[model samples]
Each structure stands twice: as structure tokens, then as C-alpha cells.
Target: MSRVVWGACLLVASTAFVACADSGQTAAVARLASGEVAVSGTPEGIPAHAPARFEFGTEASATRVAMWDIDVRPDGEGLPPGSGSVAQGREVYNVYCVACHGPTGMEGPNDRLVDSEQWDDVPSTRTVGNYWPHATTLYDYIRKAMPQLTPGILSDDQVYAVIAYILWMNEIVPEDTVLDAETLPAVVMPARDKFVVDDRVGGTGPVR
Candidate 1:
């Protein structure tokens, strides 16, 4: 072949190789003019404008995805789109909580403490209905932490339903009412008025 033709052939091969290089380095979150992002683990000849997608190194990173599995306080900010009935709460309890808090909300040997007749006298010192001052506090605590291994797995409604179920078990409220921010804080507990604040120096503590 002629020298000129040979040179042209070599140039074409080089260009083809560059175009077919590994495609592993680009973030796949932002939208470029193309409307879609390309990601790769290796970038042998990828353009600089492209996003990165490497595994161990920052050469390529992924777009952040929101995590919604955290427990939320009863304030309503983190509440999921759900509402649970006392019956529904019972279901949740049976599946996730009853094992720990006992079958009938009583203080079983290793189960969670509750307001059953067995612990009526002992529970007034710490049970949900006998000790907790605000029903919202129960919701908040349970919403953020409960069911042992899987915390914050239940939706807001489920949390409320569970709270209501537990409360009903303690004879604090009916088993049909819904639990929410508005209704939660006001559902007075037997120990509601007995709670005193850290008022050793600051007058009589936070105003009611």
C-alpha cells in the first residue's frame, strides 16, 4: 500500500479505538442538553464534559438519592402519608411490637412494658398511659424508635395507630380514634398532671 494510504488507515484505527474506549466514569444525576446522563466505570476516552461514574475513586460519582426510612417525631414534619386505626395499630403491634411489649400490653418477662392489670401498680411509674405526660410524646418516641430491629419502618399513620392501640390497652382512650399532632398532645395521660419540670432555679419551669 502507499505510505499516504497506510498513514490514513492507522489514523482511522486510532480514532475508532478512542471512540470505543471504556465507558466508566460519569455522574448520572444532572441533565445536560441531551436530557439524560451517561455513566461508566472506566473512561479510556470519554469527553471531559461528561459525568463521572467510578466505583472506588471520585473520578465518577452518583447523584444523591433521598432516604426516607428515618423515624420522625410526632410534630408532623416527618410523618408519611398514612393513617392507622386502632385495629390497624393492633395489626402493627401484633406483627412488630406485641412480641416485645407483651401479648396484652402487659410487662412480660422480656416484653416491653405496658398498662395491663399485671403491671397496673408498677406501670403507673413508667407505662405509656400511666407515666407519659403527653400522648404526642408517646407518638414521637414510638415513631422514631420501636419494633426493635426495624425502627422508623412504619408510616405516620401506623405510628399513630400503634400509639392508640397501646393507649387503649392501658385504658387511656378508645380504640377507634386517630392519632395526629393536633389530637396527640391533648390526649392527656393519667400522669400528665404529675410531671414536674426541672424548676430548681427557673421559676416553676416552662409555662404549661
Candidate 2:
């Protein structure tokens, strides 16, 4: 064949080969300009080793869900029916909290929980009395995760008592004060006014 004829034949053969190679493969997913995802594929497109149906464990039971849904709001929404006095709290703290939070919640091997002094914006100096904006949050946090070594082990009354002791140490409540669902949320935090609402909509201006 002539050189020109031979080159044309080679180009045609290459184009045909590419078309044949691409015929077996299909685009599984694609994104359109309008930000919508387009999917196109058959079961045959999946690998043979893939399972016919996936078993992602059993569905969670209502009782199991209720166990983990123990979040308490600032308004005492989820506070359980229990009470704790400062004296009772002291006992609970001595047994479970003293090791981590120190004897008086000041000499901590961990974060200090009882400082009524002014916070100098230093993170290390921030404590429950000086920095925390909500007293209920303290109860919520401790009940959810506390004692460091064994979290969620304290009973509701014990949790309340321990919180009372810490608050007493912080001078937020009187030594004889008893905290329960009604009284706990009513306890005002000292730093409550320090925090403001972040009303910035969408990714607008600087973070509040």
C-alpha cells in the first residue's frame, strides 16, 4: 500500500480499537453542572465477589436507643427524678472524683473544676465557676462522661450529688444546698452573661 493509504488505515484501526475497548465499560456515576448526581450501572457491573445483599447488623431496639438518649438540656428538660445534697455530693466526690479532680477540685491531675477567681483568658485557668456558661451543662457532661476511669457508672442521684459538691466548692451554691431537676437548672452560672448568641447566618462574617 502507498504511504498515505497505509497511514489512513492505521488511524481508522486505532479509532475502532478505542471504541471497542470503551464499549464494555459504563460510567457508574456522574455529576451534572446543576449539582445533581447521575447514576447508571447494572448488577452485572458489580464484581462477582460482592455480596448479593448487605447485612449491616440488626436494627437498634427502642430500649437501647433510650439508654443513649440521656441528654439533658439547659432548661432541665431531660433531668431525671433524683436529688443530691452537698454533703452527699462530698461523699460521692471523695470516693470517685477526688483522684482525678484533686481533694478540693483545685489540685487536679486533670482540669480544675472549682475556681471562683477571674479567668485571664488562659485555657488552663478556666474552671467550672469562672468559664462555664451553664450549670446544667456541668451535670449533663458529668452524667454522660465522668470519673475518667469508668464513665457513666454513677447513678442519677450520685451524679447529682457530685455536681452539688463541685458547685459548692465553686461557691455557686450554698454548702447545704440540695440539687434536683427543678433546682439544678435554676442555679445560675457566673459566666452565663459572658457568652452571646452566634446569629451569623450561613458562612457570612467572622465567627462570634
lDDT of 2 by residue, 41-138 (tens): 44656786877657769988878877777887666766899899999999999999898889989998998888888654554568998889878997
lDDT of 1 by residue, 36-61 (tens): 54564557787777666446544322
lDDT values of the candidates? 0.61, 0.78
The CA-based lDDT of model 2 is what?
A: 0.78
Q: C-alpha displacement of 26 in model 2, angstroms? A: 48
Q: Which candidate is the best by lDDT?
A: 2
Clashing pairs in 2: none
Candidate 1 lDDT for residue 193: 48
List clash counts for every candidate, in order: 18, 0
In model 1, where do residues sit more than 4 Å from their true spots?
1-81, 110-112, 116-124, 199-208
